[model samples]
Target: MKNKGSRRRPNKAAAPRKGEAASDGAGGDRLSKLPDDILLNILERVDTLDALRTCILSKRMLKLPTMLSRFDIDVGNLARHHDAASYGYTLNHVIQYNNAVAGVAEKILSARNLEIPIRKLRLRFYVGRDGCLSISKAFACTMATQRVDNAEFVLLTEKSCLKCTHDNLLYYAQQFNNCLGDYPAAFAGLTHLWLRNMRFGELDIPNVLSTCKRLVSLRLSNCDAGVRSVLHIEHAQLVELCIEEGKFEAVQLNGLPKLQHVNFVGWCCPDPLTFRSVPQLRKLRLEQIGISSTKNLQLSQFLANVPWISDLHLDFRSEKIWVLPESPKLLAPVLGKLQIVNLDNLPEGCDMAWTMFILEAAPSLRELCITVWDDWCKIVTDKEFRRKNGYCEKANVEWQPSDFDLKHKNLVKLTIHGFQPDVIFVRYVRRILEVAVNMGDISLHDRKVCERCMDLDPEIKVCPSRYPRTTEEKDMLKVEITKELGMASHAVIHFRS
Candidate 1:
């Protein structure tokens, strides 16, 4: 018999029998019991480093990494301190992190099973010479040995655009150009490439495009040849192109047979883009802060060459309206196939009836989405800053509908963000109801909240917001809207707070 104070010794029989697994609290190793395909699918969705760490938990999972078809290796995912100094690491730390990334990529790519083809592979690392070379060689070896379907490389500079000088950008571009020369095979197999904060030479961009034979998508942020320089892109297999904060005066799509989607942002040129020989183009998005000097765009002339666009998005950045409301007859040929339109960031306290041009132009339009908000945080509030930067003051856009009797049967849904209970908003909705007779749904949403704007000084003048709240308020608003329109509308009205 045991003493009253004595505790029982651990029982050997209660433990797992020899050659059997121990219980994992919930049960015996449930995740390891799952089939290989299901486990691999779960692992593929996470970062490659995390997947590798999970594999270390069990012997069964150790071999799964080698069988994975998709690998996403991003050095940014590495655990680091949250302090301000660690936001962008020092040179030593950056090199260390990149080396670790290169080592892991080499290990995995070298040990991959040759029987399985790589469906997708992505590597994002800092632009370090030795680490880049090692990673490029590993990628080249895998591309030569295995059947790689999609491969992407996202190269980041040591410094961000704000911290980089003109000389720094040129140096970064030269470094990347040297890397391309050293690893032609790796680049030739690349399908997607995203480059940032580099100002290449006049011929450098075209050369890079020509070398990447299989590139399907390319994004250049804060990259350009020079101010007011024209960029002519000609690629055979490219499908998607995005340019952000570039200094190019105009981007000419000279020859891209398979291109379909384009997005241009923060362009200052009068006519920023032109399309040629892009038969498959279907979607376009343009966002800019219009100044007093910027020329207003006319869609009829702007999209004359590319008449196959089905989705168009225009963002005015809440400064000035830069898109002219044109006659529907002039816009019909270009907007014939348009099915969706998103007019984002229109200034508040302005006439919105000018937007009816889209309804009259696109006979095939099925959805129209508009967001009206004047975010104080993004707009310049200081008088001196506004004058120095050439920012135009807020003003109403002048336009009158060419035909008020226009009828649209295809528009089914209308969505308005920043909906206010005011006469202007009510009148705009009534006009849409008059035009779109067969509309089925109208969704009105409150303005998007901006944290920085909330912290701003209370002295800045802005329109008072009166968005409806509570079920009773919404019901009353619906009744008032219907009463103002003086019609028994058939559309379902929803108020999303």
Candidate 2:
């Protein structure tokens, strides 16, 4: 039966609801007509709690919905329909929410009777006074007997929740004391794990990573693990590690034989990170990271320690690094093994020294990617999210090709997205064209208007290939670039909007 005031969904058949026998003559819906995997895909999109509610009272719902593998629920949407900011709200609604959580746990426990494994499960919900103690127990019972490869449990604190009340937040903070030890013991087979906004006791880090013997990737975001002291992380099987949105005084990364990638974002280490015995690391990505080097450590020293790095992405666009001025010679360290380099971020606007540093350090580099957004992200706070969707503007710089490598003969492909014609950007473009001898058609694209920014700034111009859009700004810049870049008559320059 359809509920009142609900918008009409597509006329698709659904799986049989609880208490209905598969052999019953009344259940000939199209949902039961499809294969089990397709039905599970459709169910994965709905709130996981809805499935639990429908099967709550049925004695035959012991094995859960057939072939249902992935489940996700967003607790933040609990009162999205109506403004819960009302003072008239009472304890009855809170109790009902708690009961709903307990009910879902009971339903998940029914997965014990299944033969197939749950591949992925994600829960982005609030952790009120009781936290996820009940749900974790349910997972311990069911997941211990089955396989769940990927899991993300984000416990939203009151500060992160806009609609939650102070009273409710107090309850959640007091109850969210569960640690990695509270998890299922079957985690030995898990490959990927992400925990956000959770407290980590002194030993939780090692215990969690070691428990998942096969865990290949791990992420910790906005986590509390006594960051004031040095935190050491070591694992034999871990290949990728990420720490973001938090500040740590110091970190020691050691003894990971197979580790390949390390990503750090919005992280500040007062003492430079100490890398112990990671010999197999091949890739490193640092974004908006702040490092106060007391030991006068050159960034190149860090690169030299990882001799096999093939790809490097250093995004310094978000946070400011002030010590860059004191160390203009930081880039000429040792990057001879690097093949690809992404230096698209502009620290304190653009600088010619950084570009010269990477080019001189990495002589074997083949490809370069740069962008110039229209400075819109800086002007409009409402559209700030556009920056994350690949909308960026190149910083204007006065680059002197003579002071550095005059001929970058190795670069074969050059892509310049969002070609803005400011004096600084024009200078940077002309400099690159002059140096890259083996370069092909220089791909010049205009600014991109994101889905949200499109209505406000309709030009929406950006091309991967060397072709100009029909916008007047792009057409005019195309001709100007042809004249200014000074490319030979035989050289082809693709102008794109």
Candidate 3:
């Protein structure tokens, strides 16, 4: 018997166990009690090494690393602990980081339970002698022993593209070729690969595509065979391809039966791309800064082979317009299937009527997005730099509306970024209303803010922005638009600040 006012200290043997304590809502390791599937899902989002370190803290989780089916071990993750104050890590720091990544990857791969299949494996490592060899060997062994479904490798050089010389790029490319020779099994098993700051031989890239038989995606950044070298790609399984800042004069898609997506950026050649056989291509994106010598892209002739494209994105990079406006008669055949179009970074003061060519051609177009702004910070403002780089001066694109009657019944939504309360914008909106007869919604948004743009020299003449601010101004503008158009527009106009 126990007194009601006194503490009952008699039933020590009836105390709850740790598991019972957790169930009773007392303090306990609730995370460890979670199911393995839930725990694995939580760990999969983090770096593989960090996940393994977390697992080592609990006895129940100590064996969980071996059961993991995915790994993303990147040397870039180690930069969080580094104290460097530069744009990139130092050479010694990068070397040490690569070694750490290699050690962690090897440990996990070597200790993994072979019964559990690996679904994905991604590794980003520096291209050093010892580190590359160790990493290549570990990945090769994993590919040979495990049932890996997808593998990706992002090889990095010690120096960035801006810091690397021609000799450095050549050296990196040779090292990569050697690595490919040494570890053919790993390359063969890869489904995705990214290489940067490398200048390969004339036939090196073609040979690489031939070796990577199962590759589905390939990205080359700041890498080229040589200046003005023609790159001909013909792959059986490739579905997506991206080339950024490469110096290839022409990239001929000789044959890619399964390819569906292509993205090309920072191209300077007159005619940078040619399509021969890409029957399944559906999405294409091109971004470039227009220069004096760069010829305007003619989509009518350029996309004749791939007419089934449904999604198209063209970024002018706030320079001279690089796309030539063609008649709808010539463009309709190539653009018949186009449904979505994003014309990004058109110069601020250009005549927007030229854009109507797209609306006239793509009869099935349902949504159109246009961004008009001159981002001075991204544009080279220095006269000498612009001259040296062959950048063209900012000027209005000369174009007039064709005499053909325009009527698009499919367009339902129109979005304009960097909308201003000026004649150019108002006129553009009126033209859109006249052409897009079935348009239901028109959204006008203010320009995107850029903190870097504030630091530019005051002398640089940025386009004066006159965005509607007060409610009265907005209502007045709406009234003025309706009054000038002389008809009731069925589209709901929204002015977004």
Q: Which candidate has the top score in lDDT? A: 1
Window of ten residues with lowest summed lDDT in model 2: 319-328
Tens digits of per-residue lDDT for model 3 on 1-497?
A: 76789975697566676556543345667777899999999888888878987898799999899989989998877666565553467667766887888788888998999999999999998876666777888899998899999899999888888988999989889888888888888799999999999999999999899889999999999999998888999999999999999989889999899999999998868887899889999999999988887898999999999899999999999998999989888999999999999999988877787888898789999999999988889987889988987888767766666655778899988999999988888888877887777778889999988999999998997776789889899888887666655545623678977
TM per candidate comes to 0.93, 0.68, 0.90
Q: What is the lDDT of residue 373 in candidate 2?
A: 42
Tens-place lDDT digits, model 1, residues 10-79: 8766877787776676657888889999999999999998899899999989999999999999877762
Over the full model, what C-alpha lDDT does candidate 1 score relative to the true structure? 0.88
Ranking the candidates on lDDT from highest down gives 1, 3, 2
Summarize candidate 2's per-residue lDDT along 164-268 as a digit string, tens digits. 344543344335544344554535555666655554557766777777777888887665465464568888888998887544677789788888888876555
Q: Against the true structure, whose TM-score is highest?
A: 1
